[model samples]
Target: ASSSSPKMVKAIRVHELGGPEVLKWEDVDIGEPNEGQIRVRNKAIGLNFIDVYFRKGVYKASSFPFTPGMEAVGVVTAVGPGLTGRQVGDLVAYAGQPMGSYAEEQILPANKVVPVPSSVDPVVAASVLLKGMTAQFLLRRCFKVEPGHTILVHAAAGGVGSLLCQWANVLGATVIGTVSTKEKAAQAKEDGCHHVILYTEEDFVARVNELTSGNGVEVVYDSVGKDTFQGSLECLKLRGYMVSFGQSSGTPDPVPLSALAPKSLFLTRPTLMQYVVTRDELLEAAGEVFANIASGVLKVRVNHTYPLSEAAQAHADIESRKTSGSVVLVP
Candidate 1:
């Protein structure tokens, strides 16, 4: 029993998969890592709306009774085969796949974990990977925007919204963001949004036309799906791109491809994982973000942090559209 003893650790998991109340904090045994895995001693966990999708069953999972955090910054407590850069006590951060980050210790793939720069805070690393990568793909891959391009981004004060604003601004494009109220507009403007549309009061499509002198923007990054999809498409200039990255309001109904013809527009939906399928690719994508942060070209604003046990409350805050910017969970 001594040589084969099990170790116990704390984790947050859900039961019955309903609302926020289902996120139960409990003690569970931590076990040895499998091949090519490492046990991470988490310092911070990145909380995202995707976590809510898992909790709400919008994204199907293999089973229930799960721990839903997607990304974390941690120390490498132990490592198993094929890992060299990470060793005991090495500070590191990882994002994407095998979502069990809401814990004191959990096993994850060696390749999936990336080393955190000593200069950057662990919480920022935890917060940036997923959201930053999403922004990277949206700008670089989804539809490449050039200088002087005008764009509309929704929820522009939220996690990814802030990053997109900074990235677009640095690229010399005019960035327009929409929020539900004036407070978020200020936040978005503070995040580098050139123009902020208060959607609750203004007709955003009309506002987009107003901002562009009736020519419309070159693209619209719409995450507030159902409520804004049609109008988002209408906000584009001739041959503009519509990048629908998330479903904050709800998933919009399918669009007919022919609709793009009226304005000679383009549309595509992109996810981060698809953008970085290989280790070399993932690190390259991350390296751009790391360098941007280090150089001060990009700013990672973590607007909130909650204890891992209080994840349900975090999800509730996100669902309410009240909280702005990134939310992190410290385990």
Candidate 2:
């Protein structure tokens, strides 16, 4: 594939961190790998709010200039030393890392990638890898949403939220999701949310209490952070799990551990990387995602697709919540 292509490729890299404007679409030379790596000619990129955190300088693990996409689907062009199973021209996809996406070609660790099934399209692979694994870790690994258990999820129309609804629905849990608007509420219902709360017009804490007949829920997945933190806590049943995964509405303030005393709630903020730390774990978790996708129980919503050059606009849409479900960047 590298022999078939030219020199420089257009990439979305950040020159500075502030807003979507920092994501500049410019020509960047795709480099060959040293060893234990491969150059992937990316065809599709996944747009996530975590990218917004990187762009906003809130999550400052990055240097000045870097491509900020965690997941993509592409054909391998150059394979490095010691890797035999993944060869050139092999189709693959990956998530769970950062600082190297939004470009035409990205060199990544060979072990980090998984083979793309011929049954799945490149775009679907890209869209599901990161967020699907996230859902996999959340319900399947983190707390294990079982049948007859009820759960509350914030930002129910967002990327992982969409998948969580479907996955949990299949697991037979009654899912109550919280959204900011009527449209999002409706979308969440379509995604298998048993009940949707319009947070902007509804008191979510009260609604959760009312929805469960004052029993709250077994688990509360709070990704909207600070704004929903307290409400999330109050909405859980005794011994319920509060999973604070992402800070989409900005980071939550420090909470006293004693806050859990009233209900004996369990608090855990799990990340996908931790659950998939080893090659075996990565394969098993991703295999669960792929199996569900192939079985059609997991519906990945690539609600919008933006050309690589329009990533700034894509970020703007995500920041504004103008687009719901999942948004993708097509190269």
Candidate 3:
């Protein structure tokens, strides 16, 4: 097809925010790229818990009848006028912004797209773009994990958690992870966690303290919120950093200043959008993620996949906590 060709593409549209049932598989007319935008035929789309937030109305929709995806791997089929340095047929993967990747094809700003290395599979690229880049920013920028630093990661078998465990382990950090079940505990261990705590079976704060010889961890990378927030704070050493990035369980309540006064701890709630605001930052973080994958330092485990039309079932599985590692929607 030519860059100017208009076609009907299968897309998952949300007419009303609710459960997975709200995701309607329908055909949408897609036209040529507008100014500063490029049209891509997506090969695969990444599934994150944040997608559920958008679908369930936890996160407000910018408009009605919107496509709900933020990360995908695809090839540029059309380049809008005035967009330079990007040619048609180039493979690209992108994460963050514009919120319309849940389709066979999508229009995205050229600047937001990052080149996908040929050595990496499109499915893997799609799986990792958002989650891997998130781990990149969390470990590198947020707390700056180093050799011998002990850290605790919640939901260790999750999309971002699995990547964080492996990356931190590679950086020589002593990785301790918390999971809900024994099965997930095994997966977390395989992902380079030095110690896996079954939060369902035991007290994680005690285990984290036990694992570190009562010293506690230098940082706590907590994605499971509410249920684990105070426990996460307890696992931290005095003046330790607590990076609260997501709320899978539920949002935590307001924190009083006195909450941190005991340990004089540092607390941060960071988002991927804030970390990769500029084009350079996006490229830099993405470059490292792709490089690590290419070199085998970062292994992307896409454990689950579904056709684009089955996005609803996929969402249900993720929300139920039945899926682990990364999940992708093949278009």
Candidate 4:
């Protein structure tokens, strides 16, 4: 169908929130872009843990029958009036709100989309846009990781964790990554982890203490949430920061202010939407991610890919922790 023509596109829609079984592959109508929007024929879509959060009702949806995805790379096929700096045929990638990228074609806000560098692959851009940008803000903004700074990262082989490990290492910080399996430990080590602690075999807090000679790390990036929340705080140095970004296993329990009293620690649960609220902010973060990838400093491992129709399976794999690195849905 032509970009301007109203037509049906294959998309994954959730009529109700539940398991992977709830994601239904069906035809959805696509219309011409409205003002300040552009139609994108998606080349690749990123699968993330946040998608699972929405699917399982941990994160509420604004409405029913929603398409749940936050990142995708595609070529702009149509541009609406009042939109500038974006035109048809431009390769672009976007990661943030409104949640509708799990499709072959989607309409995206002009301000939210960023141009993907020609040197970077679309699939790689799709895979890393959200996860890499999270690492960008976590290491650069949340806490500037510097030389001699030791940090702990849970789920080191994960899409976001691997990027965090590599980026933190690049910033000259010592990275202590925690993984559930020996295989993941090895992979985490290769991804620039200075110390890989297999949490399945050992207590990460004890290992972090031993590795630092009774002292703890400067920051602990804990995405595994419920299972690692308390231990993550224990792995931190006095006055350290705990960056809880996701809940792969489950949402963390309510933490009281007294929990931070012992170590005088800092806890923050940041989201990408808040960080990239402005257009300039979106471009700046995305530019850094792309530049790092193009320069070979940041390697995006698209270790798994499924067709757009198989998004349910992709979500299942991610929830099960059966996949590592980045997973993408190819259109």
Candidate 5:
């Protein structure tokens, strides 16, 4: 393919940060891959809370009127010059930086993507790549969850949370999950959560204390920022790891060093990008995730999906806490 011309495509563009209305389905121009890049015609786009964060201005974007997406599965419609092992019609998926996957077609760095297993559906691949990789590093690398280690996951029924519960259970850990409603609690239990707490009606910290016989959890994965951050610390055992990966509710206040003195808590806020900074790291993480999906070790739930044009409604549903499992956008 030549890089002399640009192609017009339909995409979800956010001109200014605000509500879901800001996500407008409009036309945009995308150029051919210059070098070390491939043009992907997206089959399915992933919907994540991070997308919402970027859309709402909670996370800064480098430019305005930008497409909002980070995960997608598609085919290599065109490969850049001088690139080998990738050809037209190859199926692939990518997650993380250089974020622009909401369009019908996009130009991506060739190395950022990995081949999707033939057995996995493109929609499922799109649904799990980002969230599954997040779960991978969190359970296997971040704290190395082991048998007899009791871990608490907030928003247990979310895209990443569901994968965490299932993978942690497979790793022989006792998984305790917290959710807002009974329906989500059931889903969490079905996802292998040993215990499900409805935080809306009960004191999660107290429940966790009782479940662990007052010893507390080895690690607390808190995504619901302000509302659950402090309580997550309270639910940890001495020297426990407090992993705050997201702030779906809102960012928590700054922590005082004194906050960790009582439990000697180890607090870390990690992102998937930092965990997979190199090509080898990217392949390793993606390989593990795809292998798990292929072996049935991880079961992705694409419980909700919307047309790419209806991304606004999808965002509204997720932000209002009305959707569960994974949400994907069909192109």
Candidate 6:
């Protein structure tokens, strides 16, 4: 029996970009694992704002009618010929690139997926893998958060934001988070945020200033781009790092160099793809995330979930800021 034949699978496909309604669940054809690839039967899939970006054309898609997803946990059902270190029936997970995890099964490069510990639930791994890795690079690599270093995380109750608060707290940094409501503020505090500001109720920059005693934060992790970009700068200390990672509020207007002159602030926009380009880097990041999860140091809240077919609803929820922690899709 040749492994080159295509098999039909259920997937969420986008024929054109616009809104959440574009995510159409339909049958798609998936071929067998080619050389250096493996076929995975996804048990769980991750939902991310980036998925929303692709759906809305904020991030250009490779082609129309594409399946949009980047993270998932599943069992390997077929291995490419001559591939080693992988086999059918192995539990594995992957995030970032080759982007086709919205389907019931997908063909992935052999090296991209990592082994999932039996102790971690498939849903939990699917929920945290991408967000956890993003948190890993943002806190440990991007800014090197340290003890006594005050930091502000916008959308602190979000997937990556929650992980950032937890990891930063474990690293001994003073974690300050911004949320829209008291419920989210409380959740952020439980996740190790030292201070949670209700941005909807008050001026966050002033609150951050007061919280830091006018010293300001060492870094501001701002994901709510257009809404929080400039205020993030105001919340920074001298030579602070302003990491703009997302734009749920829409892309921020261009800023001139003068914007940083006052504080001499450093700005960066990083992606998980760049951080985990190599297999070793991927292993290290995913390994650390799982280790922390196993040790109870990083607690993930799988607060929202939807069937893969209901991805549109999930996207709608995330876009409206009605969801907190991690969101997953069962396939």
Q: Write the per-residue lDDT of candidate 2 for residues 185-251, one digit (tens) a residue.
A: 8889999999999998889999999989999899988899989999999999989999999998889
Q: Rate the local accuracy (lDDT) of all candidates.
A: 0.87, 0.88, 0.93, 0.91, 0.94, 0.93
Backbone clash pairs in model 2 (N, Cα, C under 3 Å; residues 3+ apart or in different chains), count: 0
Q: Which whole-number lDDT from 0 to 100 does residue 105 have in model 2?
A: 90
By TM-score, the better pick of 4 and 5 is: 5
Tens digits of per-residue lDDT for model 5 on 1-331? 4797878899999989999999999989898888899999999999999999999989999998799999999999988889898999999999998888999999999989999999898999999999999999999998899998999999999999999999999999999999999999999999999999999999999999999999999999999999999999999999999999999999999999999998788999999999999999999999999899899999999999899999999999999999889999998
lDDT of 2: 0.88
Cα lDDT tens digits, model 1, 68-152, are 8888999988877556767889888888888889999998888898888887888899989888888888888788878989989
lDDT of 4 by residue, 274-324 (tens): 998888888899999999999999998899999989998998888887899
Q: For residues 1-331, could you state the per-residue lDDT of candidate 3 as single tens digits?
A: 4555777899999998788999999998878888888999999999999999999887888999999999999999888877889999999999988898999999998999999989999999999999999999999998899999999999999999999999999999999999888889899999999999989889998888788889999999999899999999999899999999999998998899899999999999999999999999999999999999999999998999999899999999998889999999998
Candidate 2: list runs displaced more than 4 Å: 1-7
1-331: candidate 6 lDDT, tens digit per residue: 2575878899999999898999999999888888899999999999999999999999999888899999999999998888899989999999989889999999999899999998788999999999999999999998899998999999999999999999999999999999998999999999999999999998999999999889999999999999999899999999999999999899999999999998888999988899999999999999999999999999989999899999999999999999999999998
Error in Å for residue 49 of model 3: 0.8
Best by lDDT: 5
lDDT of 3: 0.93
Better of 1 and 5 by lDDT: 5
Worst lDDT run of 10 residues, candidate 3, spans 1-10
Query: How many backbone collisions does model 3 have?
Result: 0
Model 6 poorest ten-residue lDDT run:
1-10
Query: TM-score of model 5 relative to the true fold?
Result: 0.99
Rank all candidate structures by their lDDT, best first, as comma-separated numbers: 5, 6, 3, 4, 2, 1
lDDT of 1: 0.87
**Local error of candidate 1 at 34, Å?**
1.1
Q: Which stretches of candidate 1 lie over 4 Å from their true place?
A: 1-5, 81-83
